[model samples]
Target: MTTLSQSGGRRLIDLVPHIVLIVGVLIFAFPIYVTLIGSTWDSATIGRGNLPLTPGGEALVNYGQAWSESHGARASYTPVRVMLLNSLVMALTIALGKIAISIISAYAVAFFRFPFRMAFFWMIFITLMLPVEVRIIPTYKVVADLGLIDSYAGLTIPLIASATATLLFRQFFLTIPDELVEAAKIDGAGALRFFVDVVLPLSKTNIAALFVILFIYGWNQYLWPLLITNSADMETIVIGITKMIGTGEAANDWNLIMATTVLAMLPPIAVVVLMQRWFVKGLVDSEK
Candidate 1:
C-alpha cells in the first residue's frame, strides 16, 4: 500500500506540470482564438458585443474584402495585398541585410587581427544600449535628407545593421576549432574562399535562427515604418492592420480588422513552424 501510494503521488506530481503547461498555453492562445472567431462575424454583431466563441458565416466575405481592399473607414483605401507584399519585401530585406552585414562583420573581427579591432567591435556592441526609440529622430532626419523617405531603402536600410547578430556570429566563430582554420590556410585558400567554404557551411543553423528572428523583427515593425512611409500603399501589414480600426465615433469595420490581423499573423507563424528545427538547434546546440 505504501509503495502504491508513493507511485501514485509521483504520477500526480508529474501530471501537475502538464496541467499547468496546458493552462498556460490556453491563457496565451485564448486571445488569438477570440480574434479568429471575431473575424468570421459581421461588424454589427461585433459592435453589439456578440463575440461568439464559434466562427460565424462572414468569414469568406471578411477575408475577401480585407484581401482585395480596405474598408476605408479608418485609413487608406490601399489593398491588404499590396500592404502584405510591402511587408514581405521589408522583412526579407531586413533579414538578409542584417545577416549579410553581421556575418561579414563577425568574420572580419573573428579571423583578422587588425588595429583596434576589439575597440571597433565594442563600438558596434555599444549601439545595443541605444534602442530605436533613442535614435529615431536622428535616423528619420538622416533618412529624409538622403532622399530615402517613403522608399524601401528608408524602410530597411536604417534597421539592417544588427550588433546582436554580429555578437552572436562572432561567438559562434570563436568556437570553431583552430586546427580547421590552420588546415584551410595550409591548403592555400584565400580569406574569401575559406569563408565561403568552411565558415558559412558551419554557420548554417545560426544563420537560419537569426533569419527567423530578424524576419519577425522587421515584419512587426510599427513605429519606424509608420514614421518612414506615408500612410499609403508603402505601409506594411502591421501598419495597415492598425490603420483599419476607427477611433472616436468613427465606426470601425471590426470584421475586416480581425481578418487583417489573422492574415498578418500567418507569415511569421509559417516561418517559425518551418524553421523550428534549425532555429532551436542554432539557439541551444553548441556542437559544430
Candidate 2:
C-alpha cells in the first residue's frame, strides 16, 4: 500500500507539470485561433457578437480589403501593405542598426585600450535604466530639431541604440580566448581585417539572435511612432490597427482589424521560425 501510494504521488507530480504547460499553451493559443477565425468572417458577423469557432468564407475578400485599403473610400486608416512596408523597413533598419552599433561598440570595448572606455560602456549600460518613456520628450525634440519626423530615420534611428545587445556582445567577446587575438596578430591581419574575418564570423549566432529580438522590438514600437508621425503614410501596422478601432465607434470593422492583427503577427513569427536555430544557439550555447 505504501509503494502504491508513493507511485501515485510521483505520477501526480509529473502529470501536474504537463497539465500546467498544456494549459499555458492553450491560454496563449486560443486568442490567436479566434483571431484567425474571425478574420475570415465579415464585419457584420463579428459585430453581432458570439463569434463562431469555424472560419467563414470571406477570407480572401477580407484579406484583400485589409491589404489594399484603396478598395473604397471608407478606409479609416492607411492600407495594411503600406503599414507593413513601413514596419518592415523600421524593423530591419533598427535591427541592423542596433546590431551593427552594438557589435562595434562591444568589439571596441572588449579589444581596444581607450581612456574612459569602461566609463563610456557604463554610460551606455546606464541608459538601459532610462527607458524610452523617460526620454521620449527629449528624443522627440532631438528628432524634431533634426527635421526627421515623418521619415524612416525618425522612426528607427532614435530606437536603434541597444545597451542590452551591447552588453551581450561584450560578455560574449570577453569569453573569447586571448589565443585568437595573438593568432590574428601573427597572421598580419590589421584591426579591420581581423574584425571582419574573426570577430564577425564568431558573433554570427549572437547577431542573428539579437536581430530577431530587435526586429520585433522595432516592429512593436507605438508611442515614438505615434508622436513622430503626423501623416497617414508614416503609420506603422501597430498604430494602424489601433486607428482602425477608433474612439468609441459602434461601426468598428472587426473583420479587417482581426485580419490586420494576423498580418502584423506574420513578420515576427517568420523571423523567429527562420532564424530559430541561431537564436537558440546564441542564447544557450556557450561557445566563444
Candidate 3:
C-alpha cells in the first residue's frame, strides 16, 4: 500500500506541471481568440460596444476593406499591401544583415588573433546595456545626415548590427572543435575557404533560429520605424495598423483595425511555428 501511494503521489506531482501549462496557455491565447472573433464583425457591431466572443459574418468584408480599400480622409493612409511589403523588406534585411555581420564578426573573434580583438568584442557587448530607445536621438541624427530617412536603408540599417546576435554567434563558434580547424588547414583551406566550407554548414541551425528571432523583432519594431519613416510608402504594417484607429472614440473602425492587427501577427507567428524545431535545436546546441 505504501508503494502504491508513493507511485500515485509521483504521478500527481507530474500532473501538476501539465495543469499549470494548460492554464498558462489559456491565459495567453484568450486575447488572440478574442481578436480573431472581433476581426470578423462589423464596425457598427463593435462600435455598439458588444463583446465579440463568436465569429461574425463580416469576415470577408472586413478583411477586404482592410487590405485593399483606403481609409478615406486620413492623410497618412497606406495600403495594407504596401505596408506589408515594406515590413517584409525591413524584416528580411535586418535578419539577414544581422546574421551575416554577426557570424563573420564572431568567426574573427573566435578564431583569429588580432590587436584590440577583445576590445572590439567588449565594445559590441556593451551595446546591450544601451537599448535603441536610449540611443535614438544620435541614431536618428546619423540617418538624417546620411539622407536615409523615409527610406528602407534608414529603417533597417540603423537596427541591423545586433550585439546580442554577435555574442550568441561567438559563444556557438567557441564550442566548435579545434580539430575541425586543424583538419581544414592541413587540407590547404585558407581562412575564407575554411569558414565557408567548415563553419557555415555547422551553423545552419543557429542561423535559422536567429533569423526567426530577428525577423520577428524587425517586424514588430514601432518607435524606430515611426520616427524614421514619414512617408506613407515606407510605413510598416505594425505602424499602419495603429494609424487605422481614428482619433475620437466614435470615429474608430474597430473591425478594420482588428483585421489589420490579425494580418500584422500572421507572418511572425508563421515564421516561429515553422522554424520551431530549428530554433529549439540551435538553443540546445549553442549551450554545448
Candidate 4:
C-alpha cells in the first residue's frame, strides 16, 4: 500500500504541470473563442448583451461587412482594409528601418574607434529611459513641423531608431573575431563591402528576432497613431478598432467590432508564428 501510494503521488506530481498548462490555455483561449464566435453573429444577436457560446452562421456576412463597411456611427467611413494596409506599412517600415539604422549605428560604434562614440551611444541609451509618453509633445511638434502627420513617415520614423536593437547588434558585433576584420582587409574588402557581405549575413538571426519584436511593437501602437494621424485613411488598425466600438452610452455593433478586432490581431500573430524559429534562434545567438 505504501509503495502504491508513493507511485500514485509521483504520477500526480508529474501530471500537475500538464494540468496547469491546460487550464492556463483554456483561460486565455476562452475569450478568443468567444470573440471568434461573437464575430459570426448578427449585430442584433450580439447587441442583446447575452453573448452566444456557439458560432453563428453569419461569419461570412459579418467579416465581409467588417472588411468593407464603415464601423460604428462615426461620420467617417474608414474601411478595415485601409486600416489593415496602414498597419502593415507602419509595422514593416518600423521593423526594417530600426534594423537598418540600428545595424549601421551598431557597426559604427562597434567597429570604429572615434571620439565621442561612447558618449553618443550613452545618449541613445539614455533616451530609452524616457518612454515615448514623456516626449510625446516635442515629438508631435517635430512631426508637425516636418509636415509628416497623417503620413507613413510620421507614423514610423519617430519610433524606428531603437537603442535596444543597437545594443543587441553592438554586443553581437563585439563577439565577431578580430581575425575576420583583418582577413577582410587583407583580401582588399572595403569597409562597406565587408559590412554588406560579412556583417549583414552574420546578423541575420538578430535581424529576424528584432523584426518580430519591432513589428509587433509598431502594430500595437495606439497613442502615437491616435495623436498623429487625423485622417481616417491614415489610421492604423489598432487605433481604427477603437473607433468601431461605440462608447458605453451609445449602441455598439458588437459583432462587427469583434470581427474587426480579430482581423486586426491576425497579422501580428501570423508574423510571430511564421518567424518563431528564426526569432528563437536569433535571440539565442544574440545573447552570445
Candidates ranked by TM-score: 1, 2, 3, 4
Candidate 2: residue 283 lDDT (0-100): 84
How far does residue 277 in candidate 2 sit from its true spot (Å)?
1.1
154: Cα error in model 1, Å: 0.4
lDDT string, candidate 3, 31-120, tens digits? 888889998998778778886698999999888877887773223357778899999999999999999999999999999999999999
Model 1, runs deviating above 4 Å: 72-77
Stretches of model 4 off by over 4 angstroms after superposition: 1-8, 71-77, 286-288
- Determine which window of 10 residues in candidate 2 has minimal summed lDDT: 69-78
For residues 198-286, what per-residue lDDT tens digits would candidate 2 score against the true structure? 99999898898888889999999989989999998989999998888773357577888889999999999999999999999988887
RMSD of each: 1.5, 1.6, 1.9, 2.1
Residue 12 C-alpha lDDT in model 4:
100
Q: How do all the candidates rank in terms of lDDT, highest first?
A: 1, 2, 3, 4
Candidate 3 ranges beyond 4 A from true positions: 72-76, 286-288
Question: Could you estimate the TM-score for every candidate?
Answer: 0.96, 0.95, 0.94, 0.93
What's the residue-level lDDT of 264 in candidate 2? 97
* Candidate 4: residue 192 Cα off by (Å): 1.3
lDDT of each: 0.91, 0.90, 0.88, 0.88
Worst 10 residues of 4 by lDDT: 70-79
Q: What TM-score does prediction 1 earn?
A: 0.96
Worst 10 residues of 1 by lDDT: 69-78
CA lDDT, candidate 2, residue 18: 99
